[model samples]
Target: MNEDQENDMIQRWVRDTPEEDLKPEDYQHIKTLGSACLTEGNSAQLLTFIQDEKNQGIVKSMGFVLIEPLVNEVVKKEKSLEHCQAAITHLTRVSKLFINHIMRHFFVSSLSSGMTFLLQLDDRKAACVGLVLSALQKQLTRLPVPYTKQLEEADEYGLCRCCTALADFTKSFVQEIKSKNGNYVGTTEDEELRTELLKFCMRSLRELLLDAELSRDRKSSLWLFATEIMVTLPAIQQSLSELLFFNSLKKSIQMDDCQSKESRACLAYLLFVQLITIESFPAVFSPVFVLQCNMEYINQLLSRYAESHLLKGLALYAKSLESVEDNSLPVSLLELQSFYNVPQNLRHILTDCPMQHLRASGLQVFQLFINKLDSEAKHKFFRCMLKTRNHAGVEGYIIKNIKNQVEFSMKPGNASKWFLGVEFLSLLGLVLHLSQGAETDLLNSMDRIMESLNLLRYLLIRDKELRSRTGVWEELCRIKDDYLKMLRVCISLSRAYYSAELKALKDNQKIKAKDQQTDCVLCRYVSQVLHSALVTFDLMESLIVRIEELTEEKLKIPN
Candidate 1:
């Protein structure tokens, strides 16, 4: 959209929000719909209508712009929660399987977008986070094409919402753990919740990282997305450690010494870091991994490739070793350790490193993954981020870095984050498409991604008049052609989300729109769940940002 149109939409949306979120009509509508969905075998009817294309598109888009603001409002206020609590209570009364069935129907599109929208608004961040997460069941399968495609269209907004919501949802949990500040063996009840949550988080992370619909630069969203889940990890250590089987997975992928040795090593470390960041660690592992595959074999293969940029980034972020000035830290390094210590195993990469690699252009984010990566490199080749140390700024640094990589702005500019995010998504989609269900042969995908990045990188470097580091810029004549190339890749990958057909209906719109009592429960409930995650995360950020504002101080860590 042009400037005027985008601005107008924003203004209208902002102005339209109600002062008090309680809407008598919304609850009445929810109750009526709840009655229908709960009636025997009606869920199949609810499911059938949404899969209809016209029904899916209009419903998914129309809800937030119309119905969802009411949902968002109710979620933000304590008094208004009765609307949601009543809905969830009624559904629970019906059957959890019924709720799960309804959610799975719209689980991807409507729910993900709802979560994103609420996250943007800071008022109800925490509760929304919890609520949003509660929407999905374990073992979610590939949804209908129309629904999944809706998500690719909604990804940026969806991801942002999910992250913000998760961040907010986990705030209390984080604080409680921090306050306790001891070796933690959580309560069995708490441990069960933590395990369920981590399983959900890791699976989501895996999917986000693997999703081809994302662009290369926007791929960093995967990490930020991972971080939202990771930052919440320390609070649920026992559960995470217990659920992830990374060690066993690591034991299986061997790096035969051919030319692929370097790539194999990188894959191993990526998987290792993936394991470590589980928010739970060594606790979940077993000697079963040792029996399955030798560490000696792993070390033998990886040691040869460890010197590549792949492993360099891992060591810097996870271990945090100090480096001699003689060899400056690689910009692609996402996690690191200080120079002083013996190599240690912390299983805490996401909290520590934002610069983990994906796609071929890993070095693009070398500078923004952490406050430290923000440090200047060679007088403007890469400038350090000039922001404060409080949580909001910290989070912004993450967002800024993520955006610089690539995401769904639709508009292209010099932001490496946005460009690369699309690239990452596209390349991931390439592999998923190419894999056609096989384990990724990274060597081939890596080659295609590297070629794409090189072309784009050359465009960025050659554009003399480009904005050096701002988030927005005109998709001007200079880099226009290359960006189009990038855009096309994402467009193709987005097809995986497409379906052979959206079920046809006889006067379907009339049936759906007329029978207001029989609303799309999947869309309504899923949206509610999403908003909860988004609002809570944003609230925590607002709280942290507000604290920074009140104290007029930044939380500085001396180098």
Candidate 2:
């Protein structure tokens, strides 16, 4: 129709139709009028009607019928600037209205169906997302305080109502993008749009879904959205499934920054706590591969000092190691040295983590992984770890495990040659002998020093067979004597140095009180280290005298 007829119809509609009595057909006529104004390069008339205060009841009665055309016009590539602005204006006004039940349904339907389709079109996807994201942002002001019950109420802009709609909207496209079961044909442009859409969803996760201020209920809503976005996408599902199921070492993949460390931790938490409980969780492969896929990622999480990241990483590591069988790792796989990576991350938890519970849990998981290996693998790991794990506490932990394994090997009917051979002796030799900087090494590595002494004491008291082996017992004696002589020297040097330092710290008159306070703490730490060294030296001396008595007894027996 011409502009004259359109104006006449608008006048008639305004003049005659009762707001309460207008039929759907009348609303359809309003939509046509709006679309016509859009086509004619001017939407000022409809915008005026929507903007005017007196006509609001009639506009409300029309019930979003005009919005669809305005949305369509706004996304059109050939639309005039005036028309697009008017369309946006009309949308903005309707947005500020009190969203009733009909408007909520319209928004839900739009997100689930109409906008989903619009987001697929290359020509319109950007404008369509811009509009929807704009609407999503507009709802933020009206949202209740985070973690409040008021967020459960229906909102003014229907954001809470459309959460599931948005989630489902994302899920459908992800399935199509990753589906391999059918001869589903799609264009390059369509694929790009689908990929872009999912990227947009990931961006929304960081920007909108992960808002710390969202109520628990709304947070759950966003999580469901995020879950659908992750679970339905083939790449993510396949990546997680392979990690959780397969055994091969896959190449490390770098994810988008949108998959922040927080997002990754959340993903791990969901898998370990929620998804793994279901029988449908893929189990065709082994859990060992899960660690392989996630080893680096888990390390990244565990490497962080944040408790949330640490807890999530620990939980994931425990679950991954749960079903793995002892002695299941092949020699070839062990040779890859990938298993050595765990100790570096575990060091944080085992030695320096501020949280006591986390430290305890970390030690538990560390032993759990250790328990999964066989004697030969354990020996290899110990040898490799001792050489590579530079941290004194971590090295001490490895030494303690070595001692345990040696005791296990000597058990009746459980004999294992891996821990008794020259290789095993050499591993011990590395820790049992003093280096050139013996005093400094002993002072700094009190844990390693103590654990080494304990391991030597255990071997001397229990392993009677070593004396029968050619040169083994004599080499052990030589190393023990050398280690003891160095330990005695270290004890003396440490006591003298720390004592002088403490006396100097106390006697310095010119030191400021704050500076003295800090130095006093340092003095206390040094004193503690010195005390530990002295205790370790006493243990070494007792073990030394016991070894000498054992040697005398062997001499009296005669060969």
What's the lDDT of the predicted structure labeled candidate 2?
0.60
Please give the clash total of every predicted structure, in order.
Answer: 68, 1
Which 10 consecutive positions of candidate 1 have the poorest summed lDDT?
339-348
Evaluate model 1: give its TM-score: 0.27
lDDT of each: 0.35, 0.60
Judged by whole-model lDDT over C-alpha atoms, candidate 1 comes out at 0.35
Candidate of highest TM-score = 2
Candidate 2 local lDDT, residue 481: 75
lDDT, residue 322, model 1 = 19
Error of 1 at 192 (Å): 2.7
lDDT, residue 266, candidate 2: 48
- Candidate 1: residue 60 Cα off by (Å): 8.5
Residue 66 miss distance in model 2 (angstroms)? 16
**Clash pairs (backbone) in predicted model 2:** 243-290
